[model samples]
Target: MMFMKSIFALAAFATAVYAQSVTIAAPVEGTSVTAGQNFTVDIARPNTLSPSQEVAVVIGLVSCSEAPFNGNCASFDVSQIFGTILYNGPYTPTLHNGPSPDFIDFYQNFTLTVPSWFTPGSASLNVAHVSLIGAGPFPDLEVKNITLNVVAA
Candidate 1:
């Protein structure tokens, strides 16, 4: 029981730490998802530190479900994706023009339907954003990946 408690404590601590950074909210690592299914790529920004005005938005769609996704998820590059951003924004995440980092709420959500053309194998979705501001935008890179398996019709 003591060991279990300790493990749980450690896990909680780790989760808390990870949540403080930009992250992927679904299609978790090492799992299998069916092709042609829609999946979400959710990225969250840390609470506001100061008044932040946006300058631009950056987006990338990662779908390397071919023969090379067998390696580490971090090894993939956003440049390999060939496409355009689904949206463009230039506003503060939550428009928190106050004095604390915990003064606002903002997040990015993208709905992705796995293209039928993607090869059935290991696949990944990567996300990152830099919200340019008068000072400097928060830098974040997040990714989620799942094995691409065919579903029985």
Candidate 2:
């Protein structure tokens, strides 16, 4: 009976440790922008959640739809930005062990610096997807397919 009880306890603990999730809320669908301006993306935890959380975002640049049909679609260079946030409560310097409240907010901003030789037209800002790892007492999570459009200067 003692061994059986210990197995059950371990299972329950595993479930609790894998219950957290993260979400990306905005820059909204179909957002538009002009060159030389800043674009914003927002991240949050669902209202149904009740635990402190942490996440990192990576941003990248890709070719616009109007690129020549034969143009190297995969040739575009990629860049990354890093950010972290504490949700729905006061910020804590330490990871985990923070108080929980209603929602946690994070943002990623991208701006285009047009090269003097480039022409003015439309391009795409791809949010290379969100990755949630190292979650404590929470499920590992991910959000994908977020993107925006910009008109070159």
Candidate 3:
């Protein structure tokens, strides 16, 4: 029981330390996007002290049913996944004035050309952002999903 309590305390502390959030502002949820069309994905990480150069973003498409909610998918099936990585490298998020004079927001915007071979149906666009936390091996991550319909262009 003592060990469990200590573990809980550590988990809470970790959560508090890594409360940074990631937002996908483009391709609004539940909207329809055409395959083979180019669309911009606007990712924003506001008021974070994490270095933008140490942050990386990975964006891809997978079946809505296969999208991971809390953690990695229980079944690691890649058959349902499609589309090449839109962007997979360090991000130099744009700095902008924040709501308060002491804060600043970082925004990373990039264009992705949807694969023309995507089946016309519902799918989830997944964005995984990784930001290094201190010098630890474990990095802070945020995963977001936007469900949208894919139509043939």
Candidate 4:
């Protein structure tokens, strides 16, 4: 019974250590912009993981109707988006007070030129974050979506 208890404890600890998430820190929800203009998207996450456990983020801006639209990107298509993979690298962690004063958050910014072909209307900015573990066959992924208003430049 004692050995079983130890195993459970270890499992819980592992789960907590692997808990991770990603958030859109800029061009906040409902933000308005113009097509053919350069815009910056800031992606943020908690700076609570070890250096070996690095993260990579891929950003894509698409029409709201084109996204999974279910608040999940389990089936997102990189080819169906308007903006390019504006960012595809590790998140640059910085020290800043976050939602809770108890902790700090870091972010990486990506600049994207809103495609000139984009129509004047609403759109969705989607991101897929892959948490790369020091040693693992499969990386964990977290997806997020934010809405933006676009107008002709």
Candidate 5:
């Protein structure tokens, strides 16, 4: 019994530590929107390799009343726009390691246009990111949430 408790405690601590690795900016919690209103969110990756690997970063923008089950949530295919993920491309970071540049972020302004079916009320904006190779949408996802108030169309 004691062993199980200790393991649970350790797991909780590890989750807290891991969560700090990523940060989200913009589209502040409780952001208000009407039908089809547009907004942006900035997600920062703590570390990246120089010359940024040629991989596609897919952002999953969704809205839900509860858990994303059945038709409860609506997904937006915010995959790629104009050959740019979000709006920016990979470049070397000022802070480099071993003479190679470090590209560690997806800094872009993406407009999240509320879907017409997103009924007016309180909903959660679920954020997810996955890195992919060409053509394949294999998901290695990390997710977060923000509160929102969706208004009428």
Candidate 6:
């Protein structure tokens, strides 16, 4: 009986540890574009455990400059145009001490309404990290992925 009780306690602890993680999938990059063309960027969060918990996503337009070193690029002049909180609907599962109980999905579309201010060349559509807070015991959360591209309009 004592051995059986210890095994059960261990299983419960492991389940709790696995239940509290928030994962943000990568954003799919759209194709090339003209200066005045309308473009759409699809941002998806396929899996979210704590959908009840709030998160802030900041999207910006930035210029990527090549560095002296190989395989390295630098970003500059981050212009913030879109920043908002994603509210996972009530049907979305709340983190109750295990991996996200349900799959959460959403998207955002951006059009190039601003006039050209930079030289004719290539730039990047950057999605800053997803900021997660007040979710269980985790103090903060951040995730990074590849930057998308935008041509001169």
Better of 1 and 3 by TM-score: 3
lDDT of 3 by residue, 57-80 (tens): 788876444335322333443334
As for model 4, its CA RMSD to the true structure in angstroms is 4.7
User: Could you tell me the lDDT of residue 143 within candidate 2?
Assistant: 30
- Candidate 6 accuracy as TM-score: 0.45
The 10 consecutive residues of candidate 6 with the worst lDDT sum are: 82-91
Off by over 4 Å in 2: 1-21, 48-52, 66-143
Q: How much is 150 displaced in model 1, in angstroms?
A: 7.8
Model 4: lDDT to the true structure: 0.69
Candidate 2 vs candidate 5, lDDT winner: 5
Whole-model lDDT values for every prediction: 0.47, 0.39, 0.68, 0.69, 0.48, 0.39
Candidate 2: TM-score?
A: 0.42
Better of 1 and 5 by TM-score: 1
| 1-153 per-residue lDDT for model 1 (tens digits) | 999999997896455434444445444665565556766655555653444433434443344544354533455555465323434453234423224664454655666565555555544444444432323444433333333343321
Q: What TM-score would candidate 3 get against the native?
A: 0.68
Please list all clashing residue pairs in model 2, or write none if there are none. 20-138, 20-139, 87-104, 88-103
Clashing pairs for model 3 are none
- For model 3, the stretches where C-alpha displacement exceeds 4 angstroms are 1-12, 15-18, 49-53, 63-83, 98-104, 135-138
The sequence of per-residue lDDT tens digits that candidate 2 reaches over residues 1-106 is 9999999978865554343333344556456655455455444333323343444444433334434412333334333321111122221122222145543333
Better of 4 and 5 by lDDT: 4
RMSD of each: 10.4, 9.2, 5.6, 4.7, 10.1, 8.9
lDDT of 1 at 55: 45
Model 6 lDDT per residue over 1-153, tens place: 999999997886455433433333333443454444555444443333442243544444433433321222233323332212122222132323223546344434333332355323344454543333333434343333334444576
